[model samples]
Target chain A: MRHDDLCHEVVSNLPTHGDCFVARDATRNDSGAIMDDENKKQINERYEKHLEKGERFWPDTIFRDLIMSLGIFTLLILLATFVGIPAEPKADPSDTSYIPRPEWYFLFLFKFLALYGQLPVIGKIEWLATVLVPSVALGVLTLIPFIERSPRRHYSKRVLPISIMTIMVVGIVLLTLMSEVPTVSEDGSTLLGTLQTVVGIFIPLTAYVLLFVFKNNTRLMLWTTGLAAVSMIFISGTVLTLAPEKKTEETEVATTLVDQIFAGQDLYSVHCTECHGDDGSIAVIEGVEGLEGEKITPIHSRDVLYTITDSAMLEVIAYGRPNAGMPPFGKTYGGELSRSEMDYIVVFMRYMWDDRFEVPQEALKPLFPPLAEGEVPSYNVHILPIVKRYCISCHRPGKDNNNYLMTTYEEILTTGDNAANNIIAGDENSYFLQVIQEQPIMNPENPEEELIGVMPPTRPLKPNVVDAFLRWIMNGMPRTAAETGALSTTPTPEVTPTP
Target chain B: MWKNIYLWLDERIGFNDLNKNLLDRPEPKTTWWNTLGSASLFLFVLQGLTGIFLTVYYTPSPDHAYDSVQYIMEGVAFGWLIRGIHHWGATLMVILVFIHMLRVFYTASFKYPRELTWLIGIGLFLTTLGMGFTGYLLPWNQKAFWATTVGTQIAGTAPYIGEFILKALRGGPDLSALTLQRFFSAHIWMIPAALAGLIGVHLFLIIKHGESHFPTKDD
Candidate 1:
């Protein structure tokens, strides 16, 4: 931009105006070399004409592209909703053998794990490959385009990035395929060696190596990318076609204690045995800490079993006690249940409860303590435990729960969850009280009384025992053992019915 | 109330200065790709606000969990809208994170001074995903209950430490009120707090260096 550097035509265009002189002006010869004006005038005239003509900048209907993209997105959402996620019914903690796999988006990584997961001690290689490699690879990917320092924008010039992305896609496909088809077993021979064909992975991997070798060849990379995409789809399709059938002929597996009890035994060995003595029994009252300041409860007590139902018991089994030394059972909760099978659990619980076992049998009185002051004699000893024994089997937590017999002590003292809406609390008018009171245990001699789904639905208890509970709630329900010590151990005054 | 309050408050550092130190710092010359991280931050704010609104009426008790959520969806004013915002915001955050990572990769920003930030970003992204994973289980419905069970099962498969991971997550030997409570705590505090700390360090590192050198030949 120095005065001497201007074209000859631009220097002549400067007029001799007052006090405004170009450095190239003839006055005083101040470096009078500059572009002459005639050429500059011509160039400026041509540019002015170009602007006066008014060129167009944009096309009409610009909204169409955006509208179309939004419309497509909305339609896809509707379609996906129709596909809808699958959901299971209320979870049963008692059933511990549920197999879990991720959604399809993560299936490729999952398949990778399946292939390399059990790799002879060192096979933890897949975890690093899947987690760390993908993570680091993705990290490098974010920084790479900037790092390459290539001024060119087109793929024709950006050789390294394109090749790396291609190889990455191929590697993912191979790993996913390997996970799905880890072996060419007998089933592969069934349909033209389908499993072997599924394991048909050599060509693509070879191509990946070839791509790395010939990274600069644009034509080869393009062709290989096209081929890889098609193969990925085809392999994924074959996997879907050959995957184990979704609906296994519904095997009517009997839900029984055999498997669970045994599974429980093995589970206890790793998790519970140290604290609860290989049985459910904890010497310390639960919520009361032992020597190690661990809160624990013994399982053998009748009070504990009555306090919670079978399903509740299963939850306690599967998830270990909190604030207590009891470690969680089963891998379901991230504990040691990883080693045991379901069949072993049933055997453990059954054995623990067996009467022939040599366990402490302190006086029954210690097992069932006296009612504290203001605590009802009928409830602490007779009524509540009986309800726990009978009604709670169906109505307790994790069960049928049509009537909430898992009612708290506060609930026993006041209204139930349904409240005055369904049951009138202690009023004989309460539907639950009415139903249980009127229903017969199992009496063929009485015309008004036969078997009824009274409460437990397991087995009816002694009739006088039922009568004792009914009398307490039916009356004003006086409490406090000091006030009614005579009724403490009195067999029910009503005639005991023979079932 | 005044004397003790003044003494207690005065003992602490200036809250305004603390905030200024974090937010009012200079921004380097970031490219378009760096915008996704900001987008993720926006979505996180959206989730936090919507979540707090949802929690106002949500009852966590198992018997009532399903009912409470349905009530939010059908009965509460603007509840469904807020929920839709939160849910879609979660998905959008995931997408934004992926885009941000891709942008960084395409630009080679993970190199040199940025590597640790990249690693921390990776951890933050996964923690974000984990937050999304664990938060859905709180409702204790059919979908939340089992989906989370399956999710925890994936953690249960982690080599060697998988079992410990699952147990710590579940809060017991099984999924219970304990699991829900622990997850809620994590969703609210652990993951979000981790994200904040990680993001603070990430931005701090970015400011320490010049904006990543844009691709140019012999410039």
Candidate 2:
């Protein structure tokens, strides 16, 4: 009479084969109830009946069950291999402008709130959508067995509950789909900031109303509700898709050279406009009272523009004009602007004040010397300025350059990181040139030498700049203009002017 | 050698008797729908396996959590595979469990003496969802943070104690380090333990009462 006895009795009444050896001894189940064989014969009859229609759970059910599980496991492996996972940028809490959205699975609830969040009255009681509605639906879902006690299982006999389930499934799917779609306009307006109640609530309510009106005709009710829901989603999606997107700030960063100059102008205003007036021509820098006595020239003046070439301008900007109170701005010189950003400021100055001097497609040659016809480049005029602008920041004395220094002619000629007297003039195998060219030398004595990486180390210097170094070295390292003319007949290649 | 080991264990464990009771039991004719329960169990086991591997590299703190997750994806060997399985497995488990319940409902498997099983199954369903909601916040990314913030706020809507519930669930009003800590523990420990216990009960009830069959023309 115990529950286990009833279970065994129930099992026994099912059909089984003639060799169906039954375990008839009273045994306690996990629940500690003794199962007896008082109705063993009757249970065997029930077993015989069910066995005619069923099989053992072991090989029959479990075998297929395991195979299905393996299929699911294989699916997980495929998704893991092919689809992969996503990890976005690290979280920055100070960035309040970031739009916070939930995972895709919870998009249904998100979309639900989005729908009801804007209405005049119901929006005030936002929890009705967030909490009350979902709870009621879940409560109904859990209470279904107690509510529906129909003895039949065929689809036709269970029309009411099945229909309700169909409608609920359709609703959740539609809402989830709606949530996934980009509903918020570019201006952060949801459905034009007005029709939220009509779209979010009334449409769903109307479908339910139709469902009640056609309750007796379950098929019609489902059809009407399903069609209505789908159409609502379709229409909303179509309208939202067709609207014009508002221009975000990112779109304003143009890609053309003119646009880059414009962008540079913006950057120049933030940094340089503080010292130089809005136009770069303010001769007496106004803001800083510290540099009031220094004779500062207008950078945009014809005299300055024609006198100081781009390379000299870059040098002044990179290493600060400390005596004149100008702070360094290049990242290399303990400042903020990158190499490319410094290029932008240079381009901006040219575009603003000296547009008549055409900016070359690339940086002009010997940006310091402004090479003349047949004028062999000098080390001080060309190489020294290039080194001061590019290398001196890291390579100068008292800095971390592996003992290399480029401040003066003697220092430039002496110290090196990998070898001594790195700059052997007229020797192409010089360690200096090799490092600049990113071709490191293996120690001939020690074959296990760890070939050091390139010099000006973070990135290779510009090709033209390296070529100038090559030309300078090949010309036997002319130090002075008179030394350059002395090396002029040293079989230097034809120095043609760049048209 | 195998036979000796089997015999040694069988003598103490009564393997034959256990097999007869658990495996050789008769059941209603199996159909495709019956496979859902097994599928749910399979995914849960998969999730547990992958979750263990992820925990090896995952830092629960807000500071290193995102970086650690990125390191797993980019740096660790087969870490992506493990995390991906865990991620997709959570979703598939929820879906399969829901379908299994639906199958039980449509067939009226909750009828008669099976009501307790159905009720336990509902508890299992809720536990699966709880596992999902808690697991989501552990990644500690933007989506995880905001989603959990909104998700927990729903629990905050309970009439009188809503404010208290919300604050307690979040470990504070705003999502913070403790929120990640709390959700990590719940996902890895609390809900999984509840799910395992409820699943045990659910299977016990199913075995106690024989499997319910589909209604036939005669019935």
Candidate 3:
């Protein structure tokens, strides 16, 4: 039960210096002594008076910690159960639209990227933020213990460090929160918006600088600077809140084709501009020449854009001319562009190159059928051509349209989205009819009415073409112009029942 | 029965001596702030356990890695919980180890005989960061992919050996299957082995030079 009896066997075995440091009153005890209960009691008293506070690691500290770790483990289990980790869409290297964001802890560094990206000189050398600054920060962090050897544990004594730490924590937290916030406005034209952000950053930074300068007036500096910091934050918050909010995602407005074409242009500039040039006229791609050693065709050239039909161009865009060194741009083809996005690119190319494809403002109205009274629209002349032109682009083989290929009548009639046939002759309830009319395309089995978008994606068929198709189906879709009269006598089995 | 077993083991191996040595050590007078080191160690153990569990199902290839993680999350029983603990435990370990370092620095406990300990602690810190960085890309998601790209690009910015380091890290100019394998090896095998050895030295140092006493008004 004596100190030396209990501890000496291990203490003696320990490296020589261990016993020396272990003896709290190193000077009081000799190099080697079998301390009795009386000496042990005095050592304990001295320990009590000299040391601040501590508990034994095993029973007291470790036990409570084991319980705390159990609690943390339980919390982690709960977090796992409720807040499930995200396993995002599989890593598709071809998908250019993906916004790569780091984990939340790294958001502060991510925000530093946004800051460094805007600055003139630092922006050029991205490693300044990405590598050098962060490396420097980490190096400083590692070296702090070696540098600051002052034996002061109390917070009150370390004003500079505590303040710097406070500022750092606050700064990192604020920056992380601001990581998603845009410096530029929606259109990306306004310098003032970015200027406001820079001013917002500098305000608190200036306050801190002033606070450091006036550290002598400690209490007054804390108050006035704290107030200034708060007020500046409030002012910046107001400015940022009131400033035109940055458009995070492009709003899909169901308006005219002009805007759709404009959106397509924007997307083209993002995805294709590097290879195809700004005007889509670059024969030799600047960066890609070394990659594949092929010269790209000028997409904006009159012979290329004007000669090729829209559907053919869509096919080229979707499937890509891999032999010609162009990669596929369609999602179905393991590329990024959706069916609608490909359509947009087509529209943009057509508008830019072929003046015949240009839409005048006056002709923007829906091209509905100006049907002559009692003159039935022909299937071959009217409906077939329209389907061939517009619907078959995506609905054909290799494209994703639920296998409802418009090429064959049987495929169209039989294949719908696992729910209903696409086009039942003489039935208004047909899926094809529903979709073309801009009506809600529903799934019959689900209790909650699920709605798929209108077919042919972004742009609907001309109203006249939709009407022609409608009349053809409603009049018991004929094989030709002559077979239209046969509808009166032929009882359409397709229209009789849903089952 | 357990006592008999303990005595049997203790008679042969002297297990009780080691246990007594560890448990009956003279602790420095300290508050809750001193517990960060223990907390960090606990989290490291937690990470090691969870990381081992993950490796059972985890595929190191670029193609299978993401799918394997998805399968672990969705198919395997309590895999999400294990993976989550590992992931969160990593962040927590980094934070706790950092706070422990800060405490040492603030108290100037890294001075005197403890300078080597502090230096070893810095190595441990770097090792812990290496674990985090290398482990991050195993998910093979966009965030992980691009973040690793940026992270390795930082190494690529070093003047003379930048290109070589970048190539060595990535196995080529771009991140590929080789890169994934390299990172996986570093995360699970290389860094952890280094950490274990460093930790051995660190604990020895802690025992050699007993934990620094809380500073009193006089000293």
Highest TM-score: give the candidate number: 2
Residue A214, model 3, lDDT: 64
DockQ, every prediction: 0.09, 0.33, 0.25
| lDDT digits (tens) for residues B13-120 of candidate 2 | 998899988999888787888999989988888898899889999999986787688778767888888888998898888889988988888776776557688888
* Residue-pair clashes per candidate: 53, 17, 4
Query: Model 3: clashing residue pairs?
Result: A53-B30, A367-A464, A368-A464, A369-A464
lDDT of 3 at B196: 91
Q: Of 1 and 3, which scores higher on TM-score?
A: 3
- Model 2, C-alpha of A318: deviation from truth (Å): 24
Which of 2 and 3 is the better model by DockQ? 2
* Estimated TM-score for each candidate: 0.43, 0.60, 0.59
How far does residue B3 in candidate 1 sit from its true spot (Å)? 34
Any runs in candidate 1 off by more than 4 Å, and if so which? Answer: A1-88, A95-99, A103-105, A115-158, A167-208, A211-226, A237-499, B1-35, B59-67, B109-117, B142-147, B150-162, B201-219
Stretches of candidate 3 off by over 4 Å are: A1-53, A121-127, A189-499, B1-8, B12-16, B26-32, B99-117, B205-219
lDDT of 2 at A76: 87
Residues A299-345 of candidate 2: C-alpha lDDT, one tens digit per residue: 78888777777768877887878877898986657776644456567
Worst 10 contiguous positions by lDDT, candidate 2 chain B: B210-219
Considering summed lDDT, which 10 consecutive residues are worst modelled in model 3 chain A? A16-25
Judged by lDDT against the true structure, how good is candidate 2? Answer: 0.70
Q: Quote the true-contact fraction of every model.
A: 0.08, 0.55, 0.35
User: Per-model C-alpha lDDT, please?
Assistant: 0.52, 0.70, 0.67
